[model samples]
Structures are given as structure tokens and as C-alpha cells.
Target: MEFSQKIDVNILRRTTFSPRVKNARIHVICGPMFSGKTTSLIKAVKSHQKDGKKVFVFKPKLDNRYADEAVVSHDKNEVQAYAVEKSVEILDYYLNADVVAVDEVQFFDDRIIDVIEKIANDGKSVVVSGLDMDYLGRPFGSIPQLLTIADEVTKLNSVCTFCSGRARFSHRISEDNGIVVLGEKDKYVPLCRSCYNELKDK
Candidate 1:
């Protein structure tokens, strides 16, 4: 018998492999403090959930300002999320998810960029929120990379506390010189370029 004739058609059909559809996309929300980045991320998650899509939300373990296992906005808007210390740990809870939302993304290590890319490439949509710049007015961790690779980028702006204009910089008000100090209105203030220059050195 010929090899083709001896082969089972059902087996061949079952063994065939096709690549996953390229429906994945990365969405990034970045801005200075109090610019509603987390709120935007939470909105995306809720929209996906309302459509009956399976969604996974994650926040850095270091971010516990509002809750230990939730993404909370400054206005008290909140959504439950997984608190992971490492970016790779997100994969452990992302199985079969249709949408993944990450808050306080700047707090995670550089590996977060790769993890988020992998998730999007696997045909799952990813939404990330973080500060684009540190208190020193420099690019924050992994946020620049995430912005570069994102399919959609939204840069929001808060009302500048000093001038009432659009805030573009996160100004530090406390005496601490550390780059990773986590605080709300007590330690950080959003300022426009002119206001920032005036207050940054003082």
C-alpha cells in the first residue's frame, strides 16, 4: 500500500498546526502623578469584563497605597488585581486570559517589558499604566520601552498644581532624595515645565 493511502485522514487533520491569529495588541497609559493612568487601566479592564471577556489585573507588590490586591485610583476608583513582586510571576496567573491590565508598571523591573510583549504576542490584549518620568523629570523604568512597543499610547496630563496648566512633570515635594519614594499628595506634586523648573532645585 502507498504511504498516503495507509495514512489516516482523521489523524492528519488532528495533527495539523496553525499559528494563533494575530489579534493581540499592546496599550499603554502613561503620565505624571494624578493624571488618571491607573483609572484608565481600570476602565479598560471593566470594559473587557462587561463584554464577558476573561481579564487579569496585576499591580506591583510595592504599590499598596490603596489596597494590597487592587488597583486604586486617587479618587477611590478601584479594581481587584494580583499583587506580584516580579514581572515573570504574572504569567502564572495569566492563563487563558483575553485581557491583561497592569498598574504601577514603572515599579516592576525591566523584565516587565518582555513579559508584556509576550502576553500581547500570544493574542491577548495588554493595558499598562505608569509614570513616564521619575520625580527627577527623567524617564522612569521600563515605561519608555513599553511606550516604544505599544500599539496604542495615551499620555494623560494632570492640572498643574502650581500654574493650573497641563502638568508634564512629576515634582517631588519631600526632602527625600531617593528615586523610588512612594507617596501621594504628601511627597509628589504635578507641575508644568515652567513650574517644575522653578521648584525642582529648591
Candidate 2:
């Protein structure tokens, strides 16, 4: 009667899926509008280029403020890039590239978080630049999560349009009430805490 419960422990063995781990490098540059986030990303990727590493630059298809397939800065600096609608599209072109750079990353879906993590886990350096917060001063899209997981984070600042002080927020000029409206100096302005609170409260 005591031997009735005897069973093989080997039957409980289960295969587990584990992604290969490497010294993945993820660098995120984020800030309010006019903060030179894109410019800093361009500089980082260019440095990688100087080191003889193959680079692939990409941007979300929604952003076309300057060029349809490029990352442009407020000062008119630009870099050619691939425009993709989905985060999964990046895998199609990044396999052979040593450095994968993404601009305007906040415009992409949450899938982007996994895509960049996978890219870096594959031993390629991943650099992303985007708005850390939306016009409403909330954490934007996947950028906040990316900032948390990144190996390095750069938070830049611009002068406030209201007080000429260090601006930490991107204020929306139009009352569109939409979270993803794309515009330049005409639709958005950088603001410091005082000005942002003052304007936002009103």
C-alpha cells in the first residue's frame, strides 16, 4: 500500500526557453522638445561610425516634420534614416548592423521596448532618442521604460520659451487635446517648471 504513490521524477522535467544573454548595451537619450535629443543620438552613432562599426538608423513612420525618412533637429541638422511603421520592422534591417539607432521612438508602440531589448541582447549596441514626457508632462510611450532598462541615459534640456531658463517640459501651444500631435516651434514650446505649472494650471 505504501508503494502506490511511487512515480518517476524525470517526468516532471520541463524544457524552458531562455534567450541568449550578452553584455547588451542600451543607451537612451530623452528630454523635452528642442532638447537636442536627436542631435545627441546622431553624434553617438557617428562616433560608432568612426570606430568602423556598421550603423542602422531608423525612425517611426509617423514623424515627418522635416523629412519622411530622416531624423532632423530643430537647428536643421539631419540624418538619413529608415522609416518603419512597427517595431518589428526593425529586425528586418538590423541583423547585420553593429549599431542600431532609433529616433522619434516615442511615436512607436510598446512593442518597441522588447525590440530594443532583443537588439541589445543580440550583442548590438542600441541607441534610442525620444521625448521622455508628452506635452501633458506624463511619461511618454515606451521611452520611460527604455530609460529604466538602458545601460546609460542622457537627459538634455532646452531654454524655456517663457523665461529663458532651463526647460524641462514640452508645452503644447494648441488645445488639440490629442497626445500624439506632431509639430515644431509652432505647436510646442519648451518650458521650465514654473512656467509650465503656471501655463498648465491656467
Predicted structure 1: lDDT: 0.91
Ten-residue region with minimum lDDT total, candidate 2: 15-24
lDDT of all predictions, in order shown? 0.91, 0.90
Instruction: For model 2, give the RMSD to the true fold.
Output: 4.8
Q: Assess every candidate by TM-score.
A: 0.89, 0.87
Off by over 4 Å in 1: 1-22
> For residues 79-170, could you state the per-residue lDDT of candidate 2 as single tens digits?
77999999999999999898899998999989999999889989898999999899989999998789889999999999999899999999
Per-residue lDDT tens digits for candidate 1, residues 105-141, read 9999999999998898788999999999999899999
* lDDT measured at residue 200 in model 1 versus the true structure, 0 to 100: 84
